[model samples]
Target: MQACQVEQLLADYGTEIYRYCRRLAGFGPDGEDLYQQTFLRLLEADLEPDEGRSPRALLYSVATGLWRNESRKRSRRAAIARPVELDGDDPPPLAGGEEPEAEALKAAENRALAAAVERLPDKYRAAVLLAYGAELPLEEVARIEKLPKGTVKSRLHKARLLLKKEMEARGYGREEL
Candidate 1:
């Protein structure tokens, strides 16, 4: 692809791709690095846009692969490094016009949900993040995951059940999730 085409792709899909990376990497510096590296890989590959493939899907596929590879490396390093506990920051205060209490409650629920998702096994986490968090259709998710559509659906179903149970255990009603 030409430089102009890459610029267009970044304009069109960059935010969604970055958001997906953040969620996939649990929202940290690692996510920011992954987001940068996704576009870099795209540029390096110099791929012509295929009529059958959406650029958004291609960006996501790249991000997912990069994250998986980095995760594997991190795991190997983790085996030798001393683990450190890190505290998560509290959610920002609600802006004007909304009820503060209600906003705070919603934030708490969201944090709980995110925590539950982070706790999920990697396979289930990837399926859930791609399908719901990134708002990708099952077919596209399957294509990116290189899994059968039925297998992706099954994984999504199982992920939803696990998330529901986790939220319930955290004192959230099913409706809230």
Candidate 2:
């Protein structure tokens, strides 16, 4: 793609792509770094999607690889480093709601849902995040995951059950979400 085209793509999709990265990377500086890296990789690859497909899907597919690679690297580092006690800092609530109390509650609920998603095993997590977080269709998610459609569907079904159970266990529910 031309420079102008690339810039346009970034302008159009950058925030959504960054949000996806943040969700995938959990919480930290690394998420922003990975977001940058995804674009860098895209530029390096200079890929054009085949006909009938949006480049948006390709952007996410690239982001997924970058996120997974970084996750693995972090896990390896954590294994080497001695464990430190967690500080239990809660992320600040999202901005803007009619009631401050309602906003705070909503933030807590979102955080809990994110944590629940984070707890999923790698395969299930990737499938669920790609299908739901990025809002990609099941067919697109299956393509990104390089899995059969049936397998992706089965995995998503299991992931949904797990997420529902996790939320309920934490005293939240689908209604709350």
Candidate 3:
């Protein structure tokens, strides 16, 4: 792809891709690094845009693959290096007309949900992040995951059940989620 075309793709999908990275890798420096690496890979691939494909899906696939590879490396490193845990800070409250208490509650719920997601198994987590975090259609998610559409749907259904159970354990009612 030409530089101009890559620039346009970044301008269009960058935010969505970054958001997906953040959700997949957690809201930390690792997420930031993954976001940059995703774009870098895209630049390196120099792929011609395909008429049948969505650029956004391609970005998500790249980001997912990168994250999975990095995660494996991290796992191996953890066996040698001293393990360190990094906790992401809560996002700032939304600026709106809503009451402060309501905003605080919403933020708490979001944090709980994020924590729950972090605890999910890799397969389920990927399905959740790609399908919902990136807002991709089920068909696209299946294509990216290289699974049948029904399998993707099944994974999503199972993921939702796990998340619901987790959220309830965190004191969030189903209605709140």
Best by TM-score: 1
C-alpha root-mean-square deviation, candidate 1: 4.7
lDDT of 3 by residue, 1-177 (tens): 677877898999988888888888878998899999988887788866568999887888888889989989988999899697786643443434654687778777788788788888878899999887877899889877878999989988998999899777665674532
Ranking by lDDT: 1, 3, 2
The global Cα lDDT (0 to 1) of model 1 is 0.84
Question: Tens digits of per-residue lDDT for model 1 on 23-129?
Answer: 88878898899999988887888866569888888888888899899989988999999579786643343343654587777877798788788888888999999
* Reference-based TM-score of each model: 0.84, 0.80, 0.82
Instruction: Highest lDDT: give the candidate number.
Output: 1
Itemize residue pairs with steric clashes in candidate 2: none
Candidate 3 to native Cα RMSD, angstroms: 5.0
The lDDT of model 2 is 0.80
By TM-score, rank the candidates, best first.
Answer: 1, 3, 2
What C-alpha lDDT, on a 0 to 100 scale, does residue 18 get in candidate 1? Answer: 83
Error of 1 at 153 (Å): 1.2
